[model samples]
Target: MSGIEIIRLPSRFDYSFHRQFGDLYTPLIEGGECDDIILDFSQVEYLDSSALGMMVLLQKKSSVNNIKVKIKGARGATDEILKMANMQKIFEFI
Candidate 1:
């Protein structure tokens, strides 16, 4: 927890995964034990608005806990979506 927690997203990162997404990061953020959280987008093929919202919420939660968040392995359309959403302001790309 003091190091980093990598949450690997799924192929379809949308509303369907909202609950699962929260389950992945909620405890880590709330525990205040982790120093960094890496969202591994390696398997993500698509992400809708809901996914964007989730990311925003996650950032808000982690920031309050002084935890860092980063994104990695985003390519093609997924990367484009993130940029269009101005995710760079909230998440560091690794």
Candidate 2:
């Protein structure tokens, strides 16, 4: 496995986020080239269930390939949302 691959999230993490990032995400997770996939939420102010679902899907995909899915830069409401979803256990946060 290689180094981490970072995917930065947009301000609003809604359903459309997957559509925009899926192309990059699918191949990266499926390629098995990285040891970790870091989702940067520095700019994300809001996120919905769809976003959470997308993250879970990403987590599953990465796990299948023996890759770690990481969450980074989540703050304020975004952090709270992730905590509320119990995502801290599911993903490595940094």
Candidate 3:
């Protein structure tokens, strides 16, 4: 079974994104036994440090659980930010 599935965040990925993550994604991640995850960032317009931190945390958790995390469809500013932060190397982009 799939571990966690996160769709692309619309527009900005700031506090609202974090709140949504906590409200939605976190529970799914915590409750599941599987570790594989896919974070779709196709429609994201912007992302800040908090979003990056959250990604890192997710990656760490996945690593600890022996899960494979995949990030797909990141483009524009969001892609740039991830690249700048060297996250592109850490995550699988498709």
Candidate 4:
């Protein structure tokens, strides 16, 4: 386990997020350089199903690497979406 790596989400988490996050998260996790990945959602106001898919993908990748994934600052609808998706079991939220 290494140090934590944080990624701040955009205002809208969509397909672009998928592409961008993939590029960023892959190396960070697969490189075995981070023990935890914290996704900051403070600036995000909306996240579509694609975003959910991205998160699940993140979870899978992180799990494969034996890394922890946390979600932070998710509020209102964004928080609700995560809860509805049962993400609490998949990620640690703070």
Candidate 5:
């Protein structure tokens, strides 16, 4: 099933992640095409609740579809946010 699709967001993750999440993530989840999803946060500097909410939504949707959502390259404030949300347990971080 190719596991997961890699979607790269812009460098300014704090500003653009929400938009990108909606534009890129919604269709992928709704399509029910893959069992795993990976979001590359290498370029992301920060993440807020909105981003966290999106992640939760994605994970929940994926769970229902029997998919796994993994996150990679998260650093700085972005990483902190994920930790604060306790999303590391839900997502495989790399």
Candidate 6:
């Protein structure tokens, strides 16, 4: 509803960050104070399926709230994994 909310993801993005991730975005989305959400993967080096699943879940929640979600700073194996998962179909990389 106002500006973008940028959430900086942890270096090792996995199921461990699931609850924290949700806590970070849920309030912003529910508050309806932002039109867009940017997930910063700049610090991330490795990620697992659970991380990918978390992203998909975010996308679903964001879409329902009419909020745009984008991923940024993905590189190396992390980037490749995301591409392999066809995450581009669900999230726009920046």
lDDT of each: 0.94, 0.90, 0.75, 0.90, 0.78, 0.93
lDDT of 6 by residue, 1-94 (tens): 7889999998999999999999999998899888999999999998999999899998999999899999999999989999999999888999
lDDT of 1 by residue, 7-52 (tens): 9999999999999999999989888789999999999999999999
Global lDDT of model 4: 0.90
Q: Model 2, which residues run further than 4 Å from truth?
A: none
On residues 1-94, what C-alpha lDDT tens digit does candidate 4 reach at each position? 6799999999999988777989879889878779999999999999998998898989897898899889999999999988998999989998
Which wins on TM-score, candidate 3 or candidate 4?
4
lDDT of 5: 0.78
Instruction: lDDT for model 1, please.
Output: 0.94
How far out, in Å, is residue 20 in model 6?
0.5
Model 5, runs deviating above 4 Å: 14-19
Model 3 per-residue lDDT tens digits across residues 1-94: 4555655666777766777776655555676665667778887888889888888877886676567778888888788889999997788887
Model 6: residue 61 alpha-carbon error in angstroms: 0.7
* lDDT against true structure, model 6: 0.93
Each candidate's number of clashing pairs is 0, 0, 0, 0, 0, 1
C-alpha RMSD by candidate, in order: 1.0, 0.9, 2.1, 1.0, 2.0, 0.6
What would the TM-scores of all predictions be? Answer: 0.96, 0.95, 0.80, 0.94, 0.81, 0.97
lDDT of 2 by residue, 1-94 (tens): 7988999999999988778778768888777688998999999999999999999988887888899989999999999999999999899899
Model 2, C-alpha of 39: deviation from truth (Å): 0.3
Which prediction has the highest TM-score against the true structure?
Answer: 6
Instruction: TM-score for candidate 4, please give it.
Output: 0.94
Arranged by TM-score, best first: 6, 1, 2, 4, 5, 3
Cα lDDT for residue 49, model 3? 93
Which residue segments of model 4 deviate by more than 4 Å?
none
